[model samples]
Target: MQCAYCTEKAVMNTPPRCKNHFVELFEKTAHETIKEFNLIQEGQTLCVAASGGKDSLALLEVLHTQYPVEALCVDEGIAGYRDTSIRDLQAYCTEKSIPLRIVSFADLGSKSLDELNPTHPCSTCGVLRRKALLQYSTKYDLIATGHNLDDEAQTILMNILRNQRQLLSRIGPKTPAQQGIAARIKPFYLIPEKEIRAYCLLKQITTNFSECPNVVKSFRWRVGEELNELERKQPGTKKNIVTAFLNKHYVREEHKRCEQHFCRRCGMPASNELCRACTLITIGS
Candidate 1:
């Protein structure tokens, strides 16, 4: 097959790119997104939420090459899942000389996964993980997550379905959740998942294939399956969904309308006296 950009042979088909071109394509697009979104400045410190998965592994590679980055891993204490992921992250960070900070579910409170009580484990686990990541991310100038196009698209659809206009407003690269929190950015926001996996394979980056065992329990995952089918039928549906939201002039205005105040309990940003994490964590197990 011939390359789409040039006459060099194509190494990937679906999108149609040559091996070198494919790599270049991925790198160039990420850089472009960073520039367009102003995701990272030249001298700022960056902390990545690396989960030892393909998305984050690929994200760390690109960011490490471009800036000084410290990797932070949140150990949610799930047996055989988060433990193995943190181990993978630890090894990779050590090998690459990147600083890795591990904050655990147990460290914050209890050490064992069995100790937590929640009606929805997967949903609760996600909240816990985000709280942990945000808590640890306090020291950095910016927090970069590995969320890609597909992830963003799925989230947009879910929020729209639920009429979560407030959450939908916070979909861009530099939207900080609340005061005192560095902005959250996703450099791969425009990159497709397929390309990330291909880049990981091409670069030979070591990453886990096994997803979190409890992922099937997520409402988001179910939505993702349906979204994938929609994407298969209608190419660029994901991009279109996100693009439409991002293009709205009221997005930033609506995001500012989030009205942040500190959580009286844990002191993180909260809409009420207690943050969602603090409120949820306090439930009887």
Candidate 2:
């Protein structure tokens, strides 16, 4: 195969990148995405949500080369999975001398995710984890995630299909800052997951490959499976879908209406009277 941007022979397949130019293309795309969205700016500290997975690891490695980044890990208290990944994340950050912080389910509430109702564990876990990330990120400029093209596309389709149009309003490379909330950004928003994996492979960045034990119980698993099949059949379908949404002005206008307000209970940013995390944590506690 030939490189997508050049005529030289290509070494990577998914959105094709040549060995000689793949790394350049990968890092260039990452930088361009950051600049395009102003994910990181002068005098602003960046805290990456490092999960020790390939995407997170790759994101940390790439960003660290250009900026001083602190890492944060959320331990959902999955007995085997989170413990193992935490070790990997810890080792990577320690070896690189980057500051790291870890918060757990126990720290947030009395019940660990394993103890929660098995039905829709991710729904509950997501609220908690997101809240933990955002809550801890209260001091930082923006909370960056390794959300690549594939992840973004699946979420867009899932939200639309679920009639959660409100969720689509927040879809973009970077979310504008709101009261009592740190802005969230996705530097890899336009990058393909395959490219990230390949970048990790090429850079020899070691990351945990273990799947989260709770993944099978999540709605994302089903949506991801279907989207993967669609992507395989129609290359660029994912990027096109997401790019179209990103370029649409009306969607963003509606998203802006999904405003933030302080939770009456915990005084953190919340859409409802009680922040979802605090609500779930209150139940779990």
Candidate 3:
């Protein structure tokens, strides 16, 4: 049978069956969440974090279809791997005429990805990227990520498992509206990983299929794979978890109070003695 929202006359024999139908679902949820969170106001400039991966590419496409978006790309100095991804990201952004800014791990510090703590290069990369993006404070009204439903669910479960209730509370579609920090929003917060991959396939977006080679050894990867398997065994599990997170738990305006002071080490905003970025860098160094 043909998909509900597909313009194509041909049909694929996949379960849940509709290729374009999921796009519509994704777009609807995206728009609704954007509206509900007031994530973007008219004439606002938004920055999208494009990792040259499927989820991020799809996010760029969807956002381009709706609002004005600029892209921020961070090259983690992963040797050839990062260069290739950066070229792909820049090419795609150039095609859409979306302004792109490139930052390098070397610029952030002399350290390369391999030079960091072997156990967690991702945390370092994330911190540096955040610091770089924040430097572009003038151009962006909001910051967006490609994190989908699966990511949110995984993070929530992981936080709960670690008994980090405070951190878990902030993992939502709309991160709390904190002052001085650019409001971060995830339009694809309700989307599933499989559906996002499908949309990328249908739209022919270029993406790196290989998981981040560095993170493969991490505990998070194991948890992520377990979650993926569980998702296959049970549909809507991610959505259900996210819904419960929203309904049963509410993130108060008080959550903002945590980062009221600036990190003494890095001068970035922070609640404790150090910002996450500074903490990671210091620990790694």
Candidate 4:
């Protein structure tokens, strides 16, 4: 398994950190997606959803070093774990001089994610996080997340298995901005999860190791494990899967239907009359 760019070293090793090579590889790939999808402009304010995990940390680092970016973290009000992750994230941001913002579920008047009525806390947390990110990011023109190829592949397969056609249509490198909100972008859409983890390790970048405290056992975990196994068996399987879906299965026009519109309830760009965040609150209310 030779390196994708350099054929000398095996792809799995701690790759050499040549600034030129690194910038060239990332910028070229990112520029291609940016051009193809019109993801961002030169002067756009980019907000990165930094989860304090390796992937998001790497995302923040890359964007801060390469482009204009602000690191945003959402705290789900999981008392013990959330504070620890925030402390570390703050330290990293302060050390690097990266602008940072913290939004808590408390600030949004939501209780702990574990207290949500939904069986899967992830559903509530995700909706709340997105809402907070959108609310806090007034100046940014784009919101970038650290979703890598492995995650994308796992999610695509998960959606397809569950017959989630609409969700499948929404899975890609680019997605519509919420009405009056910055568009979403995934610059690392082609990069594999393992590669991101490896890059973090090689760079010795510090990140939070805590998993989501309230995450229940779910099918997505099994799918993630399966994807990891497949990656081990066939290098680049995740990238290949995402590329295949983006090139062959993904329908741009069909996904355009997923475009964000103003929610009647919250006035936020939503897929429905009430955004997911408002709906969750209403259910809990």
Candidate 5:
């Protein structure tokens, strides 16, 4: 097939674009998302919540072009998986001369995620990882994440399926800063996951392609699979879901109703007396 914009052979099927055009589209989408949401402000410190995956690394690569960015990684201590990814992350950061900070479950005085033995591994790890990010990223003005369109769509559907109204309300391209938590931004909010992988290849960014060992067992994995299937059958299904959710008045109203309190144990933002991370850690202990 030929490229939509040029006679060069196409490399991506989504838009029938050649290598150069696909790369252009991917970076343009990310930059537009940031500008549309005002995700980054001038003279503000930015730290990317990188996981050494294609998505995060791709985000880091694009953002670095415009801003002085640092990388903050959370090690869930998932033995073979996280260790390999972190190695790739370290190498990339070193080559780029970007500052990198890594915090592990052990650093939080909890067992590694592999050793946590929780009923829901993803849920347990997510809470702890979020806490680790927020806890250690206080110095930064914003914490950027690599949540793409696919991830955002899956999260929206998952929250709706589980009737997690509060979480659904919190969904967006950027989250405002609360009392104790730093604001978070998602510059790749409109980019597809496939484009991110392709961008990494084109940019020669190093990333581990392995999936987390525990992902297959999570509710999100199931939801993501279903969403992918739907997206396959119906192009733009994921985008429509995110767009509708974002424009819905109910989500905005729900977000206003959502209240935040400090966890008694860690003094971080929480809805209850103890933050989700502290509660999960206590349960695991």
Candidate 6:
């Protein structure tokens, strides 16, 4: 099939575009999303939460083109998984001359995720990872994550299914700063996971395609599989899910307000006296 805008053969089915056109559309969408959300302002420091995965590397490549950005990675200390990814991240940051910072669970005085032996590995790792990001990214104005449309959709669905109104409310392109925590932005909020992989390939960004061995044990894995099946049956399902969530007035209002307390142990933003990370660390210890 011919590309919708050019004579070249189409490589993407959605909107029917060739390689060049598809890459162009993918990048343009990210820029548009940033502008639409006002995610970054002039002279503001931006840090991308690089995991050395396709999505994060793709985001770093795109955003670095127009904005001065740095890379921050969390080493969960999972053997063989995080190590390989960190190597790729280091190489990319070095080649681009972007400063890179890494924080590990060990740095937090807690054991590595693999050694933690938590009952819920993914959930445990997530809490620690967020803490690591926030703790180390205090110098940045905003922290950009590589959360693509699929990840956002999965999160929305998970929150809805679990009736987590507070979390559901916060799912969006950007999250405002609360207390001492840095604001977070998702430039790929509208970009699809497949498109991100394609962008990485087209741009020849260094990425580790390996999946975390613990992913299959998580609730998100099940939801993602179900969501993918639904999307296959009905295209645009993921986008619709996010759009509908964003259109809810209650969600928008809720996002504007948050009740935050300081973690007594770490002095970080938390709903309770102890942040989730501190609590997890206590439990693991």
lDDT of each: 0.81, 0.83, 0.73, 0.74, 0.88, 0.88
Report lDDT (Cα) of residue 21, candidate 4.
53
Of candidates 5 and 1, the better by lDDT:
5
Number of backbone clashes in candidate 6: 0
Put down candidate 3 lDDT per residue, 1-285, tens digits, no spaces: 565446554334433346566666667777888888677789877889887888888889989978888888877778657677777788789889998887775665546676764566675676677766665543566889999888888887887788765575357776643445577788888877777887888877787666677777665677788887787899667789888877753445435544567778656666688877666666556
Candidate 4 residue 226 C-alpha distance from true site, Å: 2.1
**What tens-digit string does per-residue lDDT give for candidate 2 at 209-250?**
768888887778899898889888987788999999888896
Work out the TM-score per prediction: 0.94, 0.93, 0.87, 0.85, 0.97, 0.97
In TM-score terms, candidate 2 sits at: 0.93
Runs of candidate 4 with Cα error greater than 4 angstroms are 1-37
| Residue pairs with clashing backbones, model 6 | none
Per-prediction count of colliding residue pairs? 2, 1, 0, 0, 0, 0
Note the residue pairs that clash in candidate 2: 169-255
How well does candidate 6 score on lDDT at residue 266?
Answer: 90
lDDT for each residue of candidate 5 in 77-139, tens digit (9 for 90 to 100): 888888999999999999989899999998888899878878788988988998999999999
- Cα displacement (Å) at residue 250, model 3: 3.6
Per-model root-mean-square deviation over C-alphas = 1.8, 2.0, 2.8, 3.3, 1.2, 1.2
Kindly indicate the candidate among 2 and 5 with the higher lDDT: 5
Clashing pairs in 4: none
Residue 58's lDDT in candidate 6 = 90
How would you encode candidate 4's per-residue C-alpha lDDT over 21-116 as one tens digit per residue? 554565466557767877777878888988778778878877787687789899887767777778878887888898888888777777767566
The CA lDDT at 33 in model 5 is 89
Candidate 1 weakest lDDT stretch, 10 residues: 110-119
For residue 28, model 5's alpha carbon misses the true position, in angstroms, by 0.9
Between candidates 1 and 3, the one scoring higher on lDDT is 1
lDDT tens digits by residue: candidate 1, 1-285: 898888988889866898888999899999999999888887877899998888888888888877989998887778787777777788788888999888887655643444574557776777678778888888888989999999998888888888977676557666764656767899999988989999989988877778887788778899999988999999889889889878887778877777467788777767789877777767633
Cα lDDT for residue 154, model 1?
88
